[model samples]
Target: MSMLPSARLLIVDDEEDMLRLLKRSLTADLNCEIEAVPDAVSALTLLESSRFDVALADVRMPGMDGMEFLERTKTAHPELTVVMMTAYGSIDLAVQAIKQGAYDFITKPFEHDKLVHLLGKAFERTRLIHENLLLQKRVREQESFQEMVGTSPKIRKIFETIKIISNTDVTVLITGESGTGKDLAARAIHRLSQRDQGPFVAVNCPNLPENILESELFGYKKGAFTHAAQDRRGLFREAEGGTIYLDEIGDISPTLQTKLLRVLQDKEIRPLGQTKSVKVDVRIIASTNRDLAAKIQDQTFREDLFYRLNVLSLQMPSLRERPEDIPLLIQHFLEKYSKEFGKPLKRASDEVIQIFLSHPWRGNVRELENLVSRAVLMSPGEVIREEDLDWPIRETEECLVPAEVSFLPYKEAKAQVLEKFNREYVSRVLMRNNNNVTKAAKECGLERQALQQVMRRYAIRNKELLSNEDAE
Candidate 1:
């Protein structure tokens, strides 16, 4: 355990001998600076002029007893750690002092080493509290500018885009894989925009049925549908003079797409139940993981609508593409989850961190956040370790082609050979590593995502490996 060399300690007691004794012990045993005071008045005066980490008070001081001193010190400086000293006859008073915010108490005839140990524990607690505060402050700072949580070149470019376009009224299209923080990017845009003061509405197009989704976006009259109990305003109206984020915009049906295109062009929306078109003054921001250009070619998505939505586009890079930022993201999630779960975990161990950096985060930041949250909740230690995580595993190279592959067509036979190789290779490797993806991936000479994709293609399950391991 490391000591805080700069920590200042106050020894307050009426007996000059007790004060001197404590000062001698702490100064000899601890790295902190110590001062001895004869009475509560001197301690209070010193506290006002200088900062002290911990205060050791004797219970029977004149004018102000240790109990009163502890209470006053707590009220004035709640962060300070206070320990009371009492005789054996007044053990009840020591317990009372503990109830009144005293960190701990020592008996009057305590050993010098025991007191030193107590002071060490107090200093350690103080250190942890300050470290937590500093970490929280850094978390806030890291996410303060537009609340984007990455420092990669790609993310920096997106930040620049947000800064330049936030002041404008241009529509933006954010595209990324699922869990790549598309919604967060949209919020950042809204937060930095001129209509930040207005309501920022969001609609998930795929979550609702076609007819219901329409009414949700464009409100229905009381009798428009079975569930429409009363007249309601649509998202466009709710987002008046603000931004409306349309998540999974590519998932909407052709009919809804046409209506959306009309709304985009005419700046008006006709509600399901209402006959009149409602003109809306709302900015549009859409996000999707689908390939809209390919959809247009496939005739599933409208070309004109695609052009309109793509006026200003920002594609969020996948987590694996920016491996250098993994450490920053991990620390951010560690702090976030620590606070949320009330465990307040510190950084991961070196081995755990190496695994984190090398792991192919298939689910991207979302996966990382979920893993950290789980670790913080379940980890017995204050720091995260490899055992605290559930990592994926890759296949080995022990796969062999079926005997019948030799009789198949040349091209078909080669495909069969590779498939058999991958399935067997991956499955064996997973079994060998007990289904740990990062370690298996490293052993198999493949990225975590590559191994995962192969496992997915073969419909391999980690449970299979775990069961085999159990059998072994």
Candidate 2:
């Protein structure tokens, strides 16, 4: 009989006869691939080396008893389904095994049909779990925009705009708060553009001094400066026939701006300490978090250069403006860091997710990514709880009404405070109850209709909370 490809089983028992019987019975009856191990240690080694749909381990083993093995297995591979077997099974022992995350507990003297039935259920659970994971992956793919992940209308519009702009050779200016992935947007443009085969050189304008920044943008001769040991190909030359991304462009000095404007206009660059200007062909993409318009008025930024860079512009929305994308972003980061750190995938607990949804992500997407990366390393279990997060304590201590809010009219100030409180309160209750409105309403001591009205008033979305299965 052909075994089901996806349903692979591992049977761990100390007795050689038991192992043979299990391997033969499971393979024939369930039509599943079976690997029988003589001991729990061998089973764990197999688990570390390969994937299995379910693991059946005996509670009574020679060394590293079944209970201890189960604990270690769950710690390392929390997604693996496990079922405990014991000849001396008691109600207390069964409950203990269940508490330790066993999919099921079976007495060793059980009939063949009963064992098959229990394993069948365990395999089904594994199948469903795998299917759910694939579904989540498909959902994330649908919601993503190149390297950026978001399903919100604002982000979707940004994706559309980027696609439209990628077809053109005109200069583009990307404006957004710091850490909002302006660099990613620039790269996306270059990747989709005609110069996809050419180099993409990125320069952080604010990180270098004025003299250094100029030379870095345009190549310099061997004797250009004291430290110039040899002829250098600057970022412009390095990015020939491609795109040169100037990050934090508003921070560049006026002298640099004048030089940059010349390059944009002339389509050439004069190397440092060189009399002749070298002809170049490259696209310019600039990004800034600062207010270039205000700087132009203050004479710090050149208005002419602004016009050159702003031929096409994109404004990336902040994390706060697109709060609906937070969950998807969290999922994205969790998947990223878990694989990088070699840790079993972990999902944020309902409480932790509530905190994430409420916190003002001042650092934007980068900040959230850092937080998730740390959580992946710190969390010991399958779920990332409040303790795993960096700022849950600070989140709990935040003021409902800001000091600036007190300056408003008394009625308005009070209304704002009440609105904020209701939003936070209702959202937390819904998250705890997996967004079941009736259950959350009961927990909040409000009628279902009244709670629904409050949700409508505050624009709270039922879709914001993680479902129980999703959280796991």
Best by TM-score: 1
- Across 1-472, the per-residue lDDT of candidate 1 in tens digits comes to 4676588899888888877777776786787899898999889999999988888889988998888889889999988989888988999999999999999999979987888889889998887878888998887665435555777787777778887878888889999876678898899889988899988999988667898888888887898878788998988899999999999898789999999999999999988778899899999999988888888889999999999998888898888888877788878778888888777567888887788777766567776777777778888888888887754422123437567887999999998787777876676566445577755664464556787788778778767654643553
Candidate 2 stretches greater than 4 Å from native: 1-5, 88-94, 135-151, 163-170, 176-181, 187-200, 206-209, 238-243, 250-268, 275-283, 289-311, 318-472
lDDT of 2 by residue, 258-370 (tens): 99999999999999989999988999999988888888899989999999899999999999999999998999899899999999888998898888899887668977887
After superposition, the stretches of candidate 1 with alpha carbons farther than 4 Å from their true spots are 1-144, 391-472
| Candidate 1: RMSD to truth | 11.0
Q: Against the hidden reference, what TM-scores do the models get?
A: 0.63, 0.62
Q: Tell me, what's the RMSD of every candidate?
A: 11.0, 14.6
Estimate every model's Cα lDDT from 0 to 1: 0.82, 0.85
Measured by lDDT, the strongest candidate is: 2
